[model samples]
Target: MESLEQKSSIARFLDNVFKLSENNTTVKTEILAGVTTFMTMAYILVVNANILGEAGMDKPAVFVATALSAFVGSLVMGLVANYPIACAPGMGLNAFFTYTVVIQMNHTWQFALCAVFIEGIIFILLTLTNVREAIIDCIPPLLKHAVTAGIGLFIAFIGMINTGLVKVGGAAVTLGSMRDPLVLLTVVGLIIAAILMSKNVKGAFLLAMIITSALGMVSGLITIPKGIISAVPSIEPVFMKAFSVSTSEIFSFDMVVVVFTFLFVNLFDTVGCLVGVASKGNLLNADGTLPRAKQALLADAIGTTAGAVLGVSTVSSYVESSAGISQGGRTGLTATTTGILFLASLFFAPIFTAIPAQATGPILILVGVLMASSVLQLNFSDPTDAIPAFLTFVMMPLSYSIANGIMFGMISYTILKLVTGQKEKVNKALIIISILFVCKFIFL
Candidate 1:
């Protein structure tokens, strides 16, 4: 049969390069894992466009841009990095680009894209010089664990806000009206997702999203799309706008703040995700480091710049890729497959975008549940590590900013180390970063 013959050649090549047997994964298993990963993170296409659209970018253009970025990024990750990590426009970074830069700061989206482009360039330079590895090693292990947990809270917070399960008051956030059917629908979806995830059902998160969205449609809560596919939108609207920003913007202090925040959040989040998912896939080396780490960093940097040029936000490795990693994907073929699917997704824009945010909300909450497990790595018995880590855990979601949490945690950690007579534990790189964060607050 055609299928059998195709699988034979593909399987042999994958087995030779990725050591399919050595990793206890086959071409078939890797393909399945890729699909699993794409299903979990598919919301990015719709969600990213909507988010960036708020900044006045064309929705359809951003939609196409988002998918293309993911396709190219994941392809690079597979071919160059040779890992199972999938890259896409990041969640928190997009919020920052939209709310912080374009809205609050009143900068053009073009300016924000310029900042991202510059940040990606810096990442590339750092990766080439091997500075990224040095900086990664400089971060305290406990702080890295805290970053994972903090991101969990951040994800859940985004989920709740999206579904109207939580509302922002003047001083604090309060619960939305549960009497409303929309709120109730969100609650039901979360419950379904939790139940499926607890049962270890494959594609539990994706299944929950599908079922919830279908229910929403039936109840008239979501609009049913008239068709599954749509004509590909022109990139001129977003692409032209992104490149219109002047290079002089790079010297602006506001741009510095935006770019630094992008770099900061992207760096730690990628580190935390890689550590967690690499370990799960058994893709780590004997020294507990990811192989071809520099190449991985370079691919991610390339993705960010390419994505911005293509009219999206910063690109980073997704923690949601862990869904596939846990599904026995230990090779680059998994990422390659995911990339191909992303390319195919360009044709099914209507179907992907028709998904309501409320449906995606539950998946974020469920994924947060998965990420929160990193807290188990905390050393609470030790005060120095515990105090800073705990602060990061609380402040990330509370402050609604990952960079804020990282900033405060690092400052507290350094101070606590000094006061507690553990100054030797403080590294030069961290001290420099703490100082820079302080400078950003003070000067900017």
Candidate 2:
């Protein structure tokens, strides 16, 4: 039997490990959420490295930049917002950087980085002036719900593609057979995750991934290469690469359009993510505002700037972090824990690399399902509400972009209400957003 002093010391140690403050439950929940969120997104480190390497960056540079940006950005976001959120170079934006900016526009990666930097600065100014908040407020509640749900579907689709359960096609996309070992393993992971979640299991996402990964290795579904696992320790430092461009060069008409497009897309995406995660974490105040929202926006803008300096695309808060929030995370402690994990990944990239997509894919799907729950918050009794909500939700996955879904939904809602002689219900901010959406689609 331990003495009283020894027991007290042990309790203190456990509290620290779990990040238990005076509100021990909230801290434990946040820590668990952070771990799940980390597991869901661990693939980004590997995926970004591959994408950047293919785009001519050194592998070590890509690894270092990704790790640093993820850790630093997340830390700043947490510190500023006091919310359990994480930021990184977003996946879609990076693809746009690689394919559209570099390949299609025939620009150097450095030039693309300049575009991202300029956009970040613009976003910072917009946030400071309350333009971002105004735009977010303009978005109808139903449309926001749809955007959230659409993002959830988009994430799940990406997970499917990563696990090789879905593939691009000549005519149309199609699903792969379950006979594929990777597919089978992914299904098993999904089953495990679902079962665990149903049982109110702790660490459901992480546990499912670990179990599925181990089974894959043992069943010869995932091959482990020697020496590769040890190479993660060799990842080198990535120096900040400043974007160099003349004002005239960046302010060209074409470049201006690109910058504006990036700003608009990135702003809405960030807003949608903040709303979704805030709702899940119950972080919003009575007035429907998240505490320190401006600070959160500041961190987001700063992160985007940091990513550009590190030679990546726009950085934004990831909805995947909601995976942690849904699991009971409610404080900056969870964000800090996630930041630490990202930093640790620099030396464990190989271990992360060894994780087959089949293992982590289920976690992404689970997160998508969890996030999609916002649809339940929408009021469907009124046709005025239901139509817009349905349009937004349907358009998200079908249109394959959040902006498109939002634009169409808003236009339809405004027109429907106006035609029915209910124009009084329309807000001026909504009108401005709708007009901007139209102009963006038509001219820009």
Candidate 3:
């Protein structure tokens, strides 16, 4: 009886802190959403480590850094911003850090880390000045809806590629072999998710993932980890290493380009995720702007800076957070749950890392379906709005870059509006961003 009271008291505290009642979500739902989000994106812990390891960084240390940075980023996003977004070392940015900065530019990993640190500092300044918030607000409503839908398709494409359900071919992409166990598992998982969703099952995404993993094991499609817990890896090698670079090295032309690339890509990518996820969760206000937008942007900036200090690439928001929002994660408690899981992953690395992509791929695809509903909100009657919105969403999956999608959408929107005598409709922020994007293509 005493233990039950303690449990009830803790639950009430969490409810009050997260404002669960106001958000129309229960503690159980938020926790399930968090677990769902973490499970889908857990691959980052290993993927980031492997990519950075190519640059001569210690893999074990990078793994620890990835987990810790995610923990810090997600925790702040939830506790401070009160949003259900998660952050980690981003995918494309990590590739650029390894291939462009470390290899092609002939700079050490430490130099790349310094560049990330500098870019992050700039992001913080932009957020404080309301620059980032203004950009998010100034996005045309049509394009904002398009971004939400586009990210949906983008993540679904990711799910297909990750699970080997599709592959790059002579033309663009081709179907994978039916004989492949992972592909077969993905098919089964999708079917299960479809059924669960149709039935309006609570925690459908989480349940589908668990059931899919179990099936994979039974079918020998996934190898279970031998042990669940391990000692936390040391992060000493990468910790504070960004400070080792000299000012001259950081001020070099190559480093300047690297920093700009990081800044540009992270800026829009984070914007896309924030807008896309918020739209899907109905977190945006009646005017289509997110409340506390500065706090959200600041969380991302802080994550990037802290990630660089801890020896990782640019840390930004992840679209995979949609998996949680779709599961009814309306508040920061979802993000806090994911953050705690990341912290726990340090000790249970083996178990968390063993979750197969095939298991989570189905959830992402289902999330894509949920988010694509935003397309219905678009004003398809207006050619100017329709064309830009079309390009905004189509380019995301085709180019495999959220930043590229936003760039195309913004540039086209500006030109069309100017030529069609709709200049009054386009705000100064959108115009400036479009011009900067054009300059980025020409110069950078």
Candidate 4:
């Protein structure tokens, strides 16, 4: 009788708070959805940690930070916004942070963290002032789609180079030796992943990575780590170093450009995913807006800030949450469940940190395939728009800089619009951004 009463009380609380039944969902359903979502996104831990590890950050520390950031973001979304969306350190942004900021720009990880932190705070202000909506509305759709597709190619190209599937020569990047065992294994993994994805396999990326890593291990390619389970690494390596070390750099033009890229990517990605998953769960209003849009945006902003504090890249809403919503998760309970699972992941940092980079390289490549699909949504009938979009797609991989792609795309876009008699489409916001892009080239 007592157990029955306890269950009744819990049910009443959830229904009252999240309106679970109104959404045609139950606690068990929400839990299942959460688990499904987590399984699909579990690759982020290894991928984020490994990517940031290349920036000279501690891998285990990054693993814990990634999990904790996801936990905080998802929990806040569940409780504060009553949404089923899950959040985590983003993919392309992390790659940009590590590869472009740290490697190409020669900035320390600390400086990169400072940029992310400032970007988060700016996002919070934007949400509060409702400036976010205005800014988003000002950007032309052609440029936005270009940015997404360009980043996709950028991500895939990075993975290819990292895995030695593509190599650089004096003249250009050339095909690597097909005889290399690791390269061959990555190709096999990519094919398997493509097949699984085509068949609608859940957690295709994570599963493919595991199978690939296991094969590498058997082939004497992947070396086993020193240990499987160990103490959770400390965040000291990342925590406050950025704030102190980046004072001078943070005010420079170069730092501003980096912060702007992080801001633009996180803002667009979160807004798009929030609306998408919300629509999937029927959590949006009649007018195509998330019911608690501001609250959800706040939760996302807080997640990124918290991530910076804990020492990781910018966190954003994961579109993979759509998988959860499709599983009948329609309330905050699902987000809570995902949050708990991410917190539990903190203990398995050692194992996650040990996943081979070659294994993760395949996941990045596959994700690029997913992201590049967004280009199909853009209209190519207008050359004025198509030319800029083309530039965005080509330059992202060729220049090896997301910031540069957007920068050049904007300049070309604005110039073409003016010369092609589409001057009305060029707004002041775009003009300002174009000027900044020009300054990035001339001054920074």
Best by lDDT: 3
List residue ranges in candidate 4 displaced over 4 A: 1-63, 77-116, 201-206, 223-228, 236-297, 312-342, 401-403
In order, the Cα lDDT scores of the candidates are 0.81, 0.75, 0.94, 0.78
Q: Which clashing pairs does model 4 show?
A: none
Arrange candidates by lDDT, descending: 3, 1, 4, 2
lDDT of 2 by residue, 260-350 (tens): 8788888877887786577656666655555577888888899888887776678888877877776777766677678788888776766
* lDDT of candidate 2 at residue 37, scale 0 to 100: 74
Q: Residue 263 in model 1: shift from native, Å?
A: 3.5
Better structure of 2 and 4 per lDDT: 4
Which of the two, 3 or 4, has more lDDT? 3
Question: What are the clashing pairs of model 2?
Answer: 30-329, 33-324
The TM-score of predicted model 4 comes to: 0.70
Candidate 3 versus truth, CA RMSD in Å, comes to 1.0
Model 4 Cα lDDT, one tens digit per residue, 1-444 = 999999999989988887888888888888877875675567788889899999999987888899999999999999998899898998789998999999999999999999999999998998898766554445576766666677667667877887888999759989878999888987988888788778877556656777888888888898766666567668677776658764578789888889988986677567546643464455656544446677889889999999999899999987667556655778888888898888877775555545665776666677667667768856789888888888876787897655566667778889999998889989988888788668756754
Q: 190-275 in candidate 1: lDDT tens per residue? A: 99988998898866766787898899999998889898887887888888466687767768878888888788778866765665
Model 1 residue 28 lDDT?
74
The C-alpha stretches of model 2 lying farther than 4 A from their native spots are: 1-24, 169-171, 225-238, 246-248
